[model samples]
Target: MATFLRENASELGVRYVIWQGRIWSRGAGDQGGWGRPYDGGGVYDPSDATGGHYDHVHVSVRR
Candidate 1:
């Protein structure tokens, strides 16, 4: 689901996306497409299964 939007962000007017806690913006750098490692502010963690897109996905679209 997230991959679809990311691959087609321009055509879909996607401004931002927050899923599983990680965030992605239109102009943001690659940076692994996830949050920082130390802050615990991101959604993905190898040791933690509860972090990443397991529950839901949040998307911000442009008007």
Candidate 2:
């Protein structure tokens, strides 16, 4: 899913994607990869897994 999203981010107007405690941002360049750890939008709980996005994917789109 991440791979498909990254590949078509431009067409989909995706600004960023968060999953599994990591994030991939379009502005960060592809080389940055999805290795950047997500801060969970500063609303994460200590007991939450994968920055609160462990069970599903979080996608942010450009407006």
Candidate 3:
């Protein structure tokens, strides 16, 4: 992913690229330490405390 981002950085106007994993268990909430959400969706809310319901890698590219 890094290679691809770097190769196309000029045309893509990429500024930041984030590669992360998703949650495998529903009981898993945002670990907070790794900047990964337990739900594998959006920003996690600590107040929910319900944990996440999905799992997958999160790839974000910022221009």
Candidate 4:
């Protein structure tokens, strides 16, 4: 989960983390929280859970 990755990002070599349409880089302090509209305020639709990644999460690692 986001909390775990954020706590161990440095040690785990995490480069980025994405969940619910919001992104968090290793050092980017929560990115000011998720669910902010983008691209004409339609990038994320709260009711549909379609634009945002409400179902799954994505993680990236450093090589």
Query: By lDDT, is 2 or 4 better?
Result: 2
Candidate 2 at 49: error in angstroms?
2.8
Quantify all predictions' global Cα lDDT against the true fold.
0.63, 0.74, 0.40, 0.61
Estimate the TM-score of every prediction: 0.62, 0.74, 0.28, 0.61
| Candidate 3 residue lDDT tens string, 1-63 | 544654575566655333343222222333564334344245764234332322323234454
The lDDT, on a scale of 0 to 1, for candidate 4 is 0.61
User: By lDDT, who's the top model here?
Assistant: 2
TM-score of 2: 0.74
lDDT of 3: 0.40
Tens digit of per-residue lDDT, candidate 4, span 10-61: 9999887666667667545543564232221355563445445556665678
| Poorly placed runs, candidate 1 (over 4 Å) | 33-54
lDDT (0-100) at residue 38 of candidate 2?
72
Name model 3 segments beyond 4 Å from true: 20-63
Q: Which consecutive 10 residues in model 1 have the weakest lDDT in total? A: 35-44
Taking every candidate in turn, the Cα RMSD to the unseen true structure, in Å, is: 4.6, 2.7, 10.2, 4.3
